[model samples]
Target: MDDPVLRFNLRELPVPMVYATHRIIRDCNEEFSELFGYSRSDLVDRSFARLYPKHADFVRTGHMWGAHLPGGKTYYDERIMTASDGHRFWCRVHGRTRHPTDPFAQAIYCFQALTRPVVLGKIRLTDRQRQIATLVAQGKTSAQIAEEIAISVRTVESHRARLMKAARLTNAAELVAWFSTQNSS
Candidate 1:
């Protein structure tokens, strides 16, 4: 007899693994084990719900309701999963349907790991600068903001000078407009 596991593996499905049936009642291939840090045995009888955050009810609902819709083969995108080590990652999963005679198999779910943290170091803002920008956005003069925030007028002026240099704005009007749009949403 053909090895069932080998046959599934040979399909070379792009997914992390093929889930042969419902989350609680199916098997995951070896690639799934490697990617998720769980053994096939560990995941075989567990619900995919186990991989989600405790408050993620939408995931279960989507799996139940959206799975049957036409052209809805995409499983999820940008989902947040907490790992056993307490770190979190974003992921996208795509699922494909299997043949009808395939032991109730329905979908092949591929997993893409998206847990990497990307840091952009360009143009970082300090807290003081942010506060002053907020005040500028509210149309407050440096003197007025200094009084309101219990800082010296000269200190507020210094803050404004640094903010202008950092943000590359030429004048108070540009500063105000820039701050206004930054604060809009």
Candidate 2:
């Protein structure tokens, strides 16, 4: 017996989905519009940078993913993103490219809102701070994190200090522990 064919519709998936080419949004589902507070017309042919809370994030995430997706890797991460109303919220993003050899030429992404409040060492962090904190939690030194994000080590240190102070933690170790515990929960 032949296996039955399976069919799936991007629009009917009930998740925020976007198809892009070279970082420009080509098409998106209604759920994507509802999630990001953008109309389909606003997103079509627009750069995906509009959804990022900061330019640094757009750059950093692009650099990070660019290094992987071309190798046929699927990238996943939790991050804070801005909606059309400029309100920031955490989201889990998953993405992959249709052409592994030239990943950014065409890709698909899905976003899931993480409405649960994110507390870094007890203090709420901005999206950038959260990114830095996640790196620190992974045992990356400020210099290493800076290199990875294309930022200076001093800036990474500054963000780390702010994260520590906001969480009311005395040192990196405590901050890492707090972040670890938060993720495990």
Candidate 3:
């Protein structure tokens, strides 16, 4: 296992719901049954995407496609999945390709979700800092940035210093470019 604490369907232990599916076979944990208002007998053989609109396209993404590779595994940090009532929740999805028990068949898909937020701390970067980062990403130097913003070179340097600290970068030039993409929405 790539992750030591890797758990399958552990979401059932704490979350309000959990669903598992592979092709025509499907299973729902007790929490999943209660949350979705579906009985265990009612969910078998149903397409998992029926829970969300037009789910066929989800398998087309680069991230999902990457996970389907032989002996390959991947984690999606956050994915907004829509519920039956149109509410969307962020899910941390991890998946791997499993070889079929039957020798003649192809691989199967196995996936699980984490029931916690990916980031726990308050973000330190302010809007101004992000703006500065974007400007840096645009290839602006400190003096050049100060000239555009009508600030002193020292002040721009100070902002750069603080930005690097907040963003955890080692050098101003690297931070300028990194901040540009890191802060870009």
**Each model's Cα RMSD:** 16.0, 5.1, 13.5
Per-residue lDDT of 115 in model 3: 49
TM-score of 2: 0.73
- Per-candidate TM-scores read 0.46, 0.73, 0.38
Worst 10 residues of 3 by lDDT: 102-111
Worst 10 residues of 2 by lDDT: 115-124
lDDT of 2 by residue, 37-95 (tens): 88889999999899887887887788877876885678776666788998777788899
Question: Which residue runs of candidate 1 sit more than 4 Å off their true CA positions?
Answer: 1-15, 55-76, 98-105, 115-185
Please give, for residues 45-76, the per-residue lDDT of candidate 3 as tens digits: 56556543235324333223343333533323
Q: Candidate 2: where are CA atoms >4 Å away?
A: 118-129, 136-167, 170-185
**lDDT of every model, 2 decimals:** 0.58, 0.79, 0.48
Q: Per-residue CA lDDT of candidate 1, range 65-183, in tens?
A: 24342343343333445555545554566665554333225555667886344233244545456456656766779997686556899999998898788779898889866654332
The list of candidate 3 runs beyond 4 A from truth reads 1-22, 34-37, 61-63, 66-69, 72-74, 100-185
Candidate 2 Cα deviation (angstroms), residue 164: 3.3
